[model samples]
Target: MAFRLRASLERRHLAIDIVSAIVGHVAKADRNFRHELITAFGEAFNNIVIHGYRDRTDGMLDVEAEFSTEQITLRLSDTGHEVDFAGLKPPDLDSLPEGGMGVFMIHALVDEVVYHSGTPNVLSLTKRTAAASENDGH
Candidate 1:
């Protein structure tokens, strides 16, 4: 299944809620998987709004979600300032920085993270569902 959402930064919650609802329906039996996916997605969305657009309310976010029986993938695209994803460094866990953990948390929670910087920057996150993990004898 696939779903798409286009929303302004001002009304970001609506987009998040709608996507969360879709995730809930698709991953009903796996609470942990649902939480991880949502959390990772939220972090990515926040980064786009906060860093990519620099908190500009007029900025827009284009989100696409795809689901299979064993995995879920989310792609977020924004026409904001391009990000130097290659230059991003993981947060220092020992120091526990106050506000720079979004990227770190996103990478930790999702199985895959891919970013492409361009006119419309894109960030893609994918994770295997619990069923997939169990099926693989993990």
Candidate 2:
């Protein structure tokens, strides 16, 4: 299954709600997976709004979701500033920084994170479904 959402940064919650509903429907049997994916999705959206668009509210965000028997993949694209994915590092847990944790949290929650910088920067996240993990004897 696949779903797409396009909305301005100002309407982020609506987009999140739509995506969350679809994710819930597809992964209803696995509450933990749904929660983690939704949290990662929220973090990704927030990054595009806060870092990419600089909270301008006028920038548009494009989100695409693909679900298979084994995994769910999400791609978020924005026309805002390109991200420096190479420079992003996990937050220091001991120091407890106030900001710069969204990317780190997204990395922790998802199985794969890929970033492409171009006219429209794209961040893709993928996570295997719980059933898939069980099938693999994980």
Against the true structure, whose lDDT is highest? 2
lDDT of each: 0.74, 0.75
Clashes (backbone N, CA, C under 3 Å), per candidate, total 0, 0
Model 2, 52-106: lDDT tens digits are: 8884666777777887656788888888887654436687889979988777888
Write model 1 residue lDDT over 30-63, tens digit each, in one string: 7777778788888787777777888456777777
Q: What TM-score does model 2 achieve against the real structure?
A: 0.82
For residue 5, model 2's alpha carbon misses the true position, in angstroms, by: 6.3
Error of 2 at 49 (Å): 0.9
Instruction: Give TM per candidate.
Output: 0.81, 0.82
